[model samples]
Target: MPGSGVSINALPKVSLHDHLDGGLRPATIIELAEAIDLDLPADTENDLADWFTAQATSGSLVDYLKTFDLTVAVMQTHDSLARVAREFVEDLALDGVIYGEIRWAPEQHLTAGLSLDQAVDAVQEGIEAGIDRVAQAGLVIKIGQVITAMRHADRSLEVAELAVRHRDLGVVGFDIAGAEQGFPAADHTEAFDFLARNLFPVTVHAGEADGLDSIRGALFDGRALRLGHGVRLAEDIEIGREDQDNTYVTLGPLAQWVRDREIPLELSPSSNLQTGAIAAWGDDMLDHPFDLLYQLGFRVTVNTDNRLMSGTSLSRELALLTDAFGYDLDDLEALQLNAASSAFLPLEEREELADAIVDGFANA
Candidate 1:
C-alpha cells in the first residue's frame, strides 16, 4: 500500500485537458439516450461503460473514435447538454479535483436547433449548478470551459468569437481539436490571430495524432498557451547511452524551446496507450515519455483525456503512472502543482490554486 497509502483522491488536483463530451457518465448517456429514443450498443449501464472502454482499447483508429459518436448523439439538445455538463463537474469533484477546465466543440452540438450562445449558456448553467451541489456537500470546486473548434472544419473563427463572447460566462479559453495530421493549426491562423488580438488564452490539440511539427504549429501558428496531449514532443528528445553518472539526453530545437518556455504538456497515460499515441516507443504505460519529460524538468501534467473512453480519472491516472514509473506522493504532488501553474486563470487565481494544492498535499 506504499502508493495507495496516500490516497491520490485526497490530494487536491487540477485538470487542464479533460474533454467534456468524452467525460460523459455512461448512466447519464443511457438516460439521455433513452429520452431521445437513440439506439445504443449497450442498454445496461455497466455494459455501456464496458463498451466505451472496449471500443477505445480495440487498436482500431475507427473504433476508438466511435465511442464519442454515442456520447455526442445524446448531447445534441439543451437539456441533455446541461445535464451532461453538470454531471461532468460532479464527477471531477468526486475525483478530488479542486479546479478543472472542460474543453468541447460547440459547433458539434448545433445540429439540434441550438444556437452557439444557447449551447454555451446551457453548459454554464449546468456547471454552476454542479458547483452549488459540491458546495452543499462541504466541498469546493471550480470549473472553466475551453471552447474548441474542429480542425477539419472552417468554423474556427466563428467558434473563437463564440468563446470570446462567452468569456464572462465561464468560458476561459479557446482550442482546436480533431484529426491532427493534415489539419494543422495553421489552417486556423485567422482565428488564432483574432484570439491573440483579444488576449484570449488558447490550447491546441497537438502531438497526439501527429509529431513535433504539429506541436510547433500549435505554438507558432495557434499561439497556444498549452499543448493538449503534447506527448509526442518526446520525439525531439534524444536518449543516449547510459554511463556511470547518468543517461545522456539531448533536446532538439522544438523540445528545447518548449522546456525553456515552461509550456505544460497535458499527458494522458491510459488514453495515450489506448490510442497508440506512444506506439513509436512501445505499447505500454512504461513507454510513455511522461517520466522522461518530468525528470528532464519539462512542465508535465497528468490528465484523463477522456474518462469514459479511457476508464480513468485524475487519481487513476496518477496511480497508473505510479505503477509504471514508480512515482511517489511527491511526484504526484508536483504534477498537480504543474497543472495549477498552467491553468488559464489569471495569475493571482493560479497562485491561489497552487497554494491550496500545496496545503492539501501537506495535510495529506
Candidate 2:
C-alpha cells in the first residue's frame, strides 16, 4: 500500500494519538452491551461497525464524538475496560504497531463504582496481558496509557495527578481532549503548572476542531510537547504563487515556531476528513495539508485517531497518505521515525524504538 510493491501493514509503526474508547471492536461492544443489558444501535457486529463508521463521517466533530457515548457506556466496568484495552493492544499489534500510546479519560469510567486509580490499574493489567499475548506469539509490542482529561471538565488537575501517580505503572503522559473550541487550554492552568513542575509530558488536542488560537493555547498555556491533530497548523502557512518553476510560500510566526521546534503533528488523515477538520481547504484527501506540511519540513506523524470510528488503521492511514502524496518506503519510515522520536518515553527507550524501526524498514 506504501507503493514499491511493499505492504504498508508489514512495516513497524508507532501510534501516538489513538483514543482507547474510540477503537473498541464491534463484537466486543456487542457482547459487553448484551452483558450489561444495554441497548445498541445495531444487532450484529458488522451492522454495529457500519453504524459507527456512518455516524462518524458526518463532517462534524461534535456529531462524530457522539458515537463514543455507546462505546464508553459499555466500558463502565473494570472487566469491560480491561477487555477493551486488551483488544486495543491486540489490534495494534496485528496492525504492526510496535509502540502505541492509548489515551482515554478515566473520569468517564467511574459510573460503575471504580475509582480513578482502579481504572488506571485495570487498563495497566489489560495492557500487560496484551503484551504477554503478543510475546507468546513471538512478536513484540509495547503499550502506554495517555491519561486524558476532558477539556470541558474541571478535573484536569486530578487527572494530571492520576497520570503522574501511574507514570511508573503504565501511564506515559497526560493529554487534554474533547471539545477544543470553547474550552481553551488556559482553563487548565493549574493542572498544566503542576505537570510542568513535575516535568510531565503533554499532548494537546488542537488545530482539529478550532484554529490557531487553540494551537497557541495548547502550546503556551498547556505546555504541550505535541499537538493532537495539528493539521490546522497549515492555516499559518501563506501560499503566494505557484508555477512550473516553483511555488512561493511564507510561514507565519506560529507555523515557523512549530516547524523550527520540530513538535510532532499527530495527523490523522481519515479522522480529519470525517470530522470536517480539512474542510477549510476541501473535502477530499488531496485537500489535506499533510503533504504541504511534510514538504515544508514539519514533523508530521500519521495516526488513526479512532480506528473503529474511521474504519482505519495506522497502516491504512499511511497508505491513504501514500496514495494522496505519492510517498514511498522512505516516506513511510520517516513517518514512523517521527512518531517514535515524539513518543513520551525515556531517551534510551525512544532510541531503541527508532533502531527497531530502522531495522524493520531495512528488512522490508
Candidate 3:
C-alpha cells in the first residue's frame, strides 16, 4: 500500500502557461450561456467538454484557437470573469498547484462594456477570494495575473501600460498572446520598450507557432524572461549519429543562447500536441523535444496550457511526461524548481517559492 496509497494529487506543482480564458469550467460555461441566452455547441456539460477537446485537436494552431470563441463569448461580463477567475484558482488548487500564473488578453474581454482596468480588477477580486477560501480550508496557494495583449491586435502599448499600472494590485507580469506567427514581438516595440523602461518583467508567446526568429524578437525586442510554449526552439538543434550509442548533438547560436540564458520553456505536452506545435517531430507525446531540451540543460517547465480544451490538469500533464520520459519524483521536483525560479516575482519571493517546492517534494 505504500506506493499505491500515495496521492499524486498531494504533490506540489507550479503552473506558468495556463490561460484564464481557456480554463473555464464546463458547468459555468453552461450557466453563463443560459443567463446570456447564448446557444452552445453542446447542451450538456460532458458533451461540451468533449466538443472542446475534439475541436482543439485540429492539429493546427489557428484551427485549435477557434475553440476560444465559445469560451470568450461567455466570459464578457464582469461577474462571469470574476467567477471564472475564482474557479480557475480553486481548480488549480484541487490539482495540487501551489502557485500559478494565469494569463489572458484583456482586450478580448472588453466586449461587454467593461474597461480593461475593470476586467483586471474583476479577475483580481476572484483570485483574492479564491486564495482566502483556500487558506480558510487550511491549504496554501498563491496566484498572480499575467496581463496579456493580443499580438494580432494593435493595442499592445496600451495593454503593457495597463499591466504596469496594476503590477502591485495583482498583475505580476506582461505577455503577448494570440496569433504568434506573423505578429512578431517586434511589432510591439513601443510596448516592449515601455515595459523595459518601467522595469517590468515579460514572458512572450514565442517559438510556438514560429521558429527561432520569433524567439529572437521576444528576447531582443520584448526582453522576455520566459517563453510561452517555446517548444519549437528544438528546431535550432542539430543531431548527428555515427552509431546508436554515439549520437552527437549540437546547438545553434539561438538554441545555445536560450539554453545558456536559462530561459524557462513552458512546455505543455498535451496542448502542444493538440495545437500541432510538435508536428515537425511527430504526432506522439514521446516525440516532444522536452526531454532533449531538458537533457541539454534548458529550464524546462511543465504546464496545462488550456485545461478545458486540452482536457488536462497539471498533474495529468506531469503524469504523461513521466510515463513518456520515465521521470521520477526527482524530475518532477526539478521541473517545479525551474518554474519557481523563473516566475516573475521578486527575488526574495522566488526564493521562497523554490524553498516551498524543495520542502514539499522532500516530504512527498
Best by lDDT: 2
Question: TM-score of every model?
Answer: 0.97, 0.98, 0.98
Per-candidate alpha-carbon RMSD to the true structure: 1.4, 1.0, 1.4
| Number of the predicted model whose TM-score against the real structure is largest | 2
Q: Model 3, 1-364: lDDT tens per residue?
A: 1144555678888899999989999999999999999999898999999999999998888998999999999988889999999999999999989999999998999897999999999999999989988888888899999999999989999999999999999999999988888899999999999999999999999888888899999999899999999999999999999897898999999999999989899899998998889999998999999999999999999999999999999989988888898888788889999999998888899899999989887787
Which whole-number lDDT from 0 to 100 does residue 321 have in model 3? 85
Q: Which regions of candidate 1 deviate over 4 angstroms? A: 1-4, 60-62, 242-246
Of 1 and 2, the candidate ranking higher by TM-score: 2
lDDT (C-alpha, whole model) for all candidates = 0.91, 0.94, 0.92
Residue 104 Cα positional deviation in candidate 1, in Å, after optimal superposition = 0.7
Candidate that beats the other on TM-score, 2 or 3, i.e. the better one: 2
Clashes of each: 0, 0, 0
Query: Sorted on lDDT, highest at the top, how do the candidates line up?
Result: 2, 3, 1
- Residue 336 alpha-carbon offset, candidate 2, angstroms: 0.5
- Which residue pairs come into collision in candidate 1? none
